[model samples]
Target: MKLSSLRFFKEIVFAACLAVLAVGESPAKVLTPDFVDLAEKLKPTVVNISTTKTLTPQFRMRRQPSPFPDPFQDFFEHFFEEMPRRPQRERSLGSGFIISKQGFIITNNHVIAGADEIKVRLSDGREFKAEVKGSDEKLDLALIKIDAKENLPVAELGDSAQIKVGEWVMAIGNPFGLAQTVTAGIVSATGRVIGSGPYDDFIQTDASINPGNSGGPLFNAEGKVIGINTAIVAGGQGIGFAIPVNMAKDVLPQLEEKGKVTRGWLGVTMQPMSPELAKSFGLEGEKGALITDVVKDGPAANAGLRSGDIILEFDGKKINEMSELPRLVAAEPIGKAVKIKVLREGKPREFTVSVGRLAESGDENNQKTAGDAFGLSARELTKDLAARLGLKESRGVVVTGVKQGSIAELGGFQSGDIILEIGDKAVATVMDYEKLIKEYGKGDVVRFLLRRGDSNYYLALRIE
Candidate 1:
């Protein structure tokens, strides 16, 4: 009797221990949604915006009389007052979302660029006129406010920087003016540069975003706002770009505080050093922006940045590529002193730079040009390069061949024309031209200078 009871008790104890172990050692959980409750709760804040602007059209003078006598017609013309303005309403559509319980909205700048009237429609079909809070053309971001009361639904914010490729994402917007269209896809890429802005670090997604989706929210699967839908490649599908919310966090506060953004500037035109340039510079790694021009009285110039200096880091952020420096410098707090690392003459040099506020207008840098003639190409002449090119003064590049559609003819370059330097640089040679074409590449300008038969000319060329 004692052995049977003891065995039964032992078996029961073993079974209980196994049950506890099973509960504690379960497999890792899946990242899928446990419920769609969060998404359902946040959908109400999404909005559609319709804007209209009134334009006065120009009218031509009447060719023939209105069946009136000559004296009468002349009197009517002379006696009549100025013609009344004819109002023509032009309409545009875009998307927006409520960021505040009190009805603050966010969208792209282009959405309301010339809008005279803005109407925001909520998910409940309620429409309200929105007033502009702030807008920035540099980053294409806008914040608008609408009057509303009571507690409202707000989408949660997620760390877009923490998201990775292949993670699921969703977008809700008025694509092509169609209200509340939902698209789903994975994060195709991160930190995409589509020539959008100086601080363009876009999240590439397959989610379909049309013209009207400019200000829509790119939501994570958690129903949180991670990015702002901003652009779509025209004539392309499954290609869309969103501004990462993480990058917006700092700018958002400034936008809300002063209705504008104040960024730091080093006053330099920089370019990524190619493999050839890197070898010539004796750089061990292809890292850092090659300073081409340092603005007079700019932070960089004050900090001792010089042409051919390769900036390697700022504030301890390892700058592996040249593209990272512009936004990094601009994002810094103005008037703050920062440390900059550079590679000069095959050695590392560090400098302390007092950061300066970025001027909204005017050229950021200036470099003397060297106009010269090489084997096949002629370039801008500066004291430095002119010494190399046997020239005495600064001028533009000279073209010997007007190749068909090969940067020359397409640029309207004549056989003997000189090409003055365009953006970032004053006058340019093939090297400067290549550096410039590869640098400050956020725009469509590919300007040049031309000298034809002893006459100087300036030409606007498109960088294809």
Candidate 2:
């Protein structure tokens, strides 16, 4: 090789090395976010929340007799009975971030639920009494307000829909009562449904979120709040979950205006579309929610949606999974007519249905009773019937009749058996039983807790 060619080759390699170094430096700066400055700016927006709940103790009758003699026993019994049982106060700590200069804050509903008094403490050593403006138990979110009487430092809300996994994030909360604690880690995952609730779109992160971190702010690299730290896996390290800020933002207006969330209801019970079920439906792949049942006269039913229909899209959004449909349906405005694309018997169809408001409590009148499906007739347990059944309390539904050779009879259900619970949820009324029973579909094995002759026993019945 010539000397001039060798020198030119060496110079080219050196220039390429310099170009690589320049490209790497920019991403290194982007990846290693300045947490110290971010923490200082966000600390004022985050606040410590302390709640006090008054719990009244229930007195249970003593079952065993005193070990002492009659006179000593009588004296001890009277003395203990006369003693006053005072109401107990429980104190809990959580974290919240100011969203508005008018003192509005966002936190998890579990934090301030049943709290008789709530106190908010700012990082500047100021304290104020807070009140719950609105709460949604289904979403586990609460909007609270404090009368600071001045403009407060508010956190910048970011679009969580743009958040991707492996992005650097920071959490600011009062974990374990440690106020203004900051933790940083990358987003572990997104759209995680850990069975938290119907809308279980949580942003999973490795940020250290502890007991008292509920309702804190999860920030992006730009110091904008993207999530609300809400839950953590028990005994698991670097596993935490946060509510997406976009969801919170959607609920905030309703919470601030109505003091409760009124979600749009589709009045349909659905299950995940499995590959086998998809094949049975003549679908190439499992990409839609399979409707198990539709409430009679419901918005869906009125729109001609049937039990066998497969929901492919709702309001223009593609329904890729069963879990996505509920969140999408709930977000729609009530009374607004929206297009629903469904596959019925392997044929495409569309329907325009007006969304209905979901009742906060399950409305039994609107729900389909479980009698026809289960082949059992049940009546609400009245006080008179409770006495007849030798029950101390009038609760649950008493089985009035059972069909011959039906699933109920096969499951050992008798006429006098009281249905206490269905599928692990307590059935205090016939409505509760009906609403819960409708959640299961064909081929699903459902467990029922029955109180038969002063004893409780669970019965497993497969729906055929």
Candidate 3:
């Protein structure tokens, strides 16, 4: 063969090898996704929310010089019922997402909390008046409906329970009134509790969530919303919190059906079982919810659950943390029987408890009442009082009024505190408390066990 022919053959072989290497080797790295297409597809589902609130003037605007003299000014001010008083209308802006093609939108409860009128604007520049369907302040979630007279785009809610930390997530909202803004970041953390409420399982992320982003949706890579951007820590950069979509899914149906969420009540206040508490209780592991108080005649009480019992498991699920118990109990079916395992008196015990529907907390009087001997007025802790004070049970006498500068007030006794015990003796009734106090005279130091807002502590008072 000629030299030219041999060279052409080598070139052909090299070209073939290059084609095979190209098939085996991967392409250049794309650090991030091309969010342009995804943003365009998701923007239509996101909406901008503007609300108007009506406020009445607290002080009358300076009155113009009246024709009458100053002596008649007092009479005119009191008698003028229909003065030209201007009612102030305050406007606020936020973000929301369409959950249904029929115009059902979801946003933060705070956004539309006191709004007299709520308006929703779409990416297409169309606006519509929205009606609040339901709201849950505890979760900071609200659902509103709008009549756009056309088929609207809907965003799918993803299973937030399956989301992992460091996963890429997108937040779409009207941040700082800039409508339909999109920001991306990875999930910085999960199950974060920033002291918002009892159900404070927030997904912490680095996404730029601002004031208007309160109601916006946090989406996964698949374009599905896994969380709702609800809060941002002040003076922090790239630190934001979102309510997991799984939590919202749990209460959304109830909100839509009953206009409120009905949580299952175990009637027991609880705290984390610390390592020290676990060792003291003869437990091997630092896992369980330490029961502080048991509501009298409530589900737990009727089930033989006591205040000192440490809950290890509920409804076949393990209670690894204190916060886990609330979410588990709240997810329980109302009126359904569930098995609860507890460690009482350093022994494992189990009981079957019937869940009860949570009732609304009522207002209690905040004035001083009776007990001049102790410089405090006390009453039986009623169910309403327990609910109002966030107590687990109505098992003891509650301090209704604490006289200032008195021994009770000086000893740190406050109104709404439930007196559980006096120096190792249980005081369930007002008579019991009075009798216990009668045993302690002046110059005596009495230790009182008290329950206040889901916490239990002992206070010592030196009788004067």
Candidate 4:
């Protein structure tokens, strides 16, 4: 064969090799979405909830004059009952999702609080009147129900207990009344508390949740609902928190079964006893909630529990701190017999106690009541502070020193204030208060009904 013919054959082979290589190489990454489908699928179920609450005429306007202007004060209050001297219309917006086919939806309680009318607008442009099924302000969660002739789209609930930090997540809500807006980000953290309440184990995310996004769905990458957006810490952008679906699950059963939550009470005030206090009492580990006071006839009392006793275990789980007790106990059923382990005076002891139902606290006398003790230095309420606060208590205990702005101070208790009760019982004597304080190895709260002069006050001071 000729040299030119041989060269032509080699060129053809090289060209074929290049063609095969091109075919084998993977294409540059293009969007083959996992989230786009999620957005489309979940958007329909996410709804806009608008609440109309009537506020007193006084509440609508600032009692303290606005620093900026007062041009509308006189004209605003006159002729317009809506102006807020008597009654006025107050409206707000939030986000929600249909959790059931029968129009069961979920949102934040603050969204619909005091709302005389709740209107829910769907992704399909249809609107319906929604009724609040139940709400728990302690958790900042609420369940709403609407009338729908058809089965509504329900988002899938995922196990939040399985969620991890830094996982990709999506938030769907009505941001600033823009319904069904979707933002994407990763989970920033978990188990965060923003002074919302006890049991605040939140899933933090960088999703763009704004003013109207409260009570919306925070979905995992697999399109499962893992959390419900509740709040954003102030001065924080790209930071928001959601109630873990697991916590939401705990409240849903009660909301569906009963219109309100019924929590179990041990009638004990408690707190996380510091390592110093724990060591002084001979506690083995630094963990466990310290019982400040066990109520008379309360489940804990019947079980031989006492103040200064460190609760190590409830049922089968170990108690790590005093704040952990309420979330655990409230999860228990009333009247249920359960095992409780405590470290008494440095020794571990165990017992069984029947839980008790909690009832409304405080009464008309504005007399002191609730909790078990006030750890601060206190004395019998005198006529001086009573006259100053405009309260009428003569025998109630007065707070002399709040330990230099401790939890009591932050709880709105001042020096010279009066205390009324522990948990639910009245404290008429320092012995009564001491007994209550002794029951708690740590301090959770000292419920007080106070008299300052002509005024009576109810204050819950967090001891833990």
Q: lDDT scores for all predictions?
A: 0.73, 0.86, 0.83, 0.75
Off by over 4 Å in 2: 1-30, 60-84, 362-464
| Residue-by-residue lDDT tens digits, candidate 2, 90-115 | 99999999999999999999999889
Instruction: Give TM per candidate.
Output: 0.69, 0.75, 0.69, 0.68
Superposition error at 60 for model 1 (Å): 12
Error of 1 at 208 (Å): 1.6
Could you tell me how far off, in angstroms, the CA of residue 123 lies in candidate 1 after the best superposition? 0.4
lDDT per residue as tens, model 3, 158-229: 999999898888999998899999999999999986545668799999988888998999998889999999
Worst 10 residues of 2 by lDDT: 58-67
Cα-based lDDT at residue 294, candidate 2: 83
Best by lDDT: 2
Off by over 4 Å in 4: 1-33, 59-84, 360-464
Stretch of 10 with least lDDT, candidate 1: 366-375
| Count of clashing pairs, candidate 3 | 1
lDDT ranking, best first = 2, 3, 4, 1
lDDT per residue (tens digit) for residues 1-464 in model 4: 69999999999999999987786684322223387888999899899999898764323222332235677777755645443356678889999998999999988988887789999999999999998888886677889899989898998899999998878899999888887899998899987654345475788899888989999999987788999998874555898889899888888988887867777778786755677887798876589887766677777888788887888999999887555677888888889999998887667788998988765223242212322224356654434334433444556666655542345544556665566666677878655776676565455555567655446667665556
